[model samples]
Target chain A: MNKRDIALIIIILIIAVLSYCIMNISSDKDGDMVLVTVDGKSYGTYKLHEDREFEIQNEYGYNIISIHDGEVCIKDADCPDKYCVKQGKISKNNESIICLPHKLVIETVRTMDDGGAGDIDSVAK
Target chain B: MSKHVAKLGIFIALAMIFSYIEVLIPFSFGIPGVKLGIANIVVVTGLYILKPQEVFVISVLRILLMGFLFGNMLTLVYSLAGGILSFVVMLVFKKITLFSIIGVSAAGGVFHNFGQILMAAFILHNEKIMYYFPVLLVAGVITGILIGFLSDNIIKALKHYN
Candidate 1:
C-alpha cells in the first residue's frame, strides 16, 4: 500500500469512529415518543413512558410492539427472521427496530415537553 | 468498436452473476441493506479497463437488468442510488489519480452505502434513519476493502493474460 492508500484507510477509520460516537450520543434518551411506520406510511406515535401493547398488521405480516418504563421493543413478529424482536429494547431517539420482511419500522423520536414543540422541531425546521 | 461492446457486456454479465451468488449464499448480517456488495468488483475492474462512458453504461445497465431479473421497484431505487453514487465517486478518484485502485474502490463502497441510506431515509420519511449511517460506514469500509483486494487481483490477472 502506498501513502495515499494508507491515508484513505486512515480517513475511513476516523469517519467510522466519529460516526459511531455520533450515533451513540444522538440516541440519548431525550425523546419520550416512538413512531411506528408501515411501508413508509405513518402508523402512529406513542408515548414511551406509558405501558401498552399493540399489534401492527399489514399484507406482508405483523409486528407486535410493547412499550413500558420508557423503552420500546418488538414483543413478537411473524416475519421469518425475528430480527426485529431480537433488536431488544430502545429508549432513545433514532434507535429503531426494523422488520424488513414486514416493512415495519419502529423508531424512537423525541418530542418536546410542550406537545406543539415536536411539530415545530420536526416540520418548521 | 465491437470488441468494446462485447467486453462491457461480459462485465455486466459477471456483475449479475456475482449478485446472484450473493443472494444464493444468504449472507444477511441482520442489519437491513448490509451485504458484501461483491458485484462492485466488476465496476472497479471496469473503471480501470474501460472508457468512462462505457463504464457508466455498464454500471447503469447492470443495475437495471438486475433489478428487473431479481428485484422489485424498491430494489431498483436502492440499487440505482447506491450504484450511481459509487460509480461517480470511483470516477472522481480515478481522475485524481491519487490513490490505488483499492483505495478508489474502497471509497466507492462507502459512498454506495451513503447513497442507499439517503434514499431509504427519504422513502421511509424518517430522519432517524441517519442512525444507520455509522454502522453502514463501518460495514462499507470492511466490504470495500474485501472487494478492492478482489478487484485488484482480477485486474492484475487480466493484464497478465492480455
Candidate 2:
C-alpha cells in the first residue's frame, strides 16, 4: 500500500478507538431504571430492582422482558435469530438489548425523570 | 454476450458458496453487525477481473440469492445496504489507483459495516445505533484487511493459472 492508503487506514482506526472510549465513558452512569420502547414509542419505565416478567406484543411479534435482581434481559423472543435473548443481561447505563425485526428496545438508564436520558437513543440489537 | 452472462453467473455462484460457508460456521465476535465477510472476496476479485457492470450484477445477485436461501427480509435489507455501499466505496478506491488491492478491499469492508448501521439507525429512528459504530469500525478493518490479503493472493493465483 502507498502512504496515503496507510494514512487513511490509520486515521479510521484512531477514530474508531476514540469513539469506543467516548461511548463507554457515557455508558458508565450507575443505572437504576429500565426503559422499554416499541416502534419508536415509549412502552413504559420499570424499576430495575423489581422482579417481573412482561411480554410486549407488536406488529412483528413478541418479546418477553425479564427484570430480576437489578438487571433486565430478554427472557425470550419470537423473532428470528433470538438476537435479543442472546444479549444476556444489561444493568449499566446505555447498555441495551434490541430486537430490530420487532422494533423493540430495552435500555438501562440512571433516571426515569430526565425525560431524555433513556429515550431510545440507540438500537444495538 | 451470452458468454459474459455465463461468467457472471459462475462468479455469483462462487460468492454464494462463500456466503453459505460463513453461515455454517459459528463465527461471532460477540458484536452485532460484525462479520468475516468471506463472500466479499468474490466481489473484490471481480473488481479487477470483471467490468464494473458485471461486478455490480454479480454482487447484487449473490446477495439476493443468499438471502433467499438462508436469510429473512431484515437480513436481506441489511445485506443489500452493506453490499451496495461496500461496492461503491471499493470502486472509488480502485479508481483512485493509489491503493493496492488490499487497501481497496479494506475500504469496502469498513463502508459495508457503516452502511448497515446507517440503515439500522434510520429504521429504528434511534441515533443510539451509532454507538456500535466504533466496534463495527474495528471489525471492518480487521475483516477487510484479511479479505484484501486473501483476494490479492487469489488474484495472483488466477493470473498464474490463466
Candidate 3:
C-alpha cells in the first residue's frame, strides 16, 4: 500500500466514524411509539408503553410484532430471511427493524404530544 | 485474441469458485448483507491483467451465474448494483495511477456497499435503512484491504505470464 492507499483508507474510516456519530446523535431521543409501514404506506402505529402483539398479514407475507416495556421487536415472521426477527429489540428514535422481502419497515418515533396526536393527525391527513 | 479470451474465461471461473466458497463458509456477522466478498479478489486481479471492459464483463457474468444458481432475483438486482458501482469506482481509482492496487480495490469494496444500500433504501422507500451504512462501510474497508492484499501478491506472482 502506498501513501494514497493509506490516505484513502483513512478517509473511508473517517467517513464511517462520522456517519456512526451522526446516527447516534440523531437517535438520542427516546421514542414512545412504533410505526409500521408496508410498502411505504402506514399500516399502524402502536404505543411502546403497551404490551401487545400485532400480526401483519399482507400479500407478501406475515410478521408478528411484539411491544413490551417500551421496547419493540418482531416476534415472528414468514419472510425467508427472518432478518427482522433476528434484529432483536429497538426503542430509540430512528432505530428500525426492516423486512426487505416483504417491503415492511417498523421504526420508532417520538410523538409531539403526550397523547401522540401528532402521529395520528398526520396519518389521518 | 484467443489467448486473451482464454485468460478471461479462467478469471471468470475463478471468481465463481470464490463465490461458491463464500457460500459454503457460513460467514455471517448477522447484520444482513454483510459478506467477505472473497470473489472480489478475482476482480481486483483482473484489473491488472485485463482491459477495463473485459473485467466488467467478467464481473457481470459471475454475478449473473452465481445469482441464478444460489440467489434470487432480488439478490441479482442487489449484486448488479453493487458490482457495477464497484467496477466503476475501481476503474477510476486505477486510472489515477497514484494509488496501488490495494487502494483501487478498497474503493471498489466501499462503493459496492454504498450501491447496495442505496438500492435497498430506494426499493424499500425507507431512508431509515441508511442506518446500516456506517457498519457496512467499516466492513467494506476491512474486506477491501484483505482482498487488495491478496490481489497484490497474485499480480506479482503472475507478472511473468502477463
lDDT tens readout by residue for model 2, B124-147: 877777888998888898889899
Model 2: residue A33 alpha-carbon error in angstroms: 2.1
**TM-score per model over all chains:** 0.84, 0.91, 0.92
What is the lDDT, from 0 to 100, of the residue B38 in candidate 3?
90
lDDT of 1 by residue, A94-113 (tens): 67887756777887766665
Q: C-alpha displacement of B13 in model 1, angstroms?
A: 1.5
Per-residue lDDT over A1-125 for candidate 2, one digit per residue giving the tens place of the 0 to 100 score: 57876887898899999989988986776578888878777789889998999988877998899999999999998987788888799998878888888888788876644536444343223
- lDDT (tens digit, per residue) of candidate 3 on A49-82: 9999988998888999999999999999998778
Q: Candidate 1 on B1-162: residue-level lDDT in tens? A: 897678777998998898889878857777666889788888888888788887888888889998898877777888899999999998998899998887888899899999988887777666666777888887887788888899889988999767
- Best-fitting candidate, scored by DockQ: 3
Candidate that beats the other on lDDT, 2 or 3, i.e. the better one: 3
Model 1 captures what fraction of native contacts? 0.47
lDDT (Cα) of model 2: 0.85
Ranking by lDDT: 3, 2, 1
The C-alpha local distance difference test score for the whole of candidate 3 amounts to 0.88
Index of the highest-TM-score prediction: 3
Better of 1 and 2 by lDDT: 2
Output the worst ten-in-a-row residue range by lDDT, candidate 2 chain B.
B26-35
Interface RMSD for each candidate model? 2.2, 1.6, 0.9
Better of 1 and 3 by TM-score: 3
DockQ of each: 0.50, 0.62, 0.79
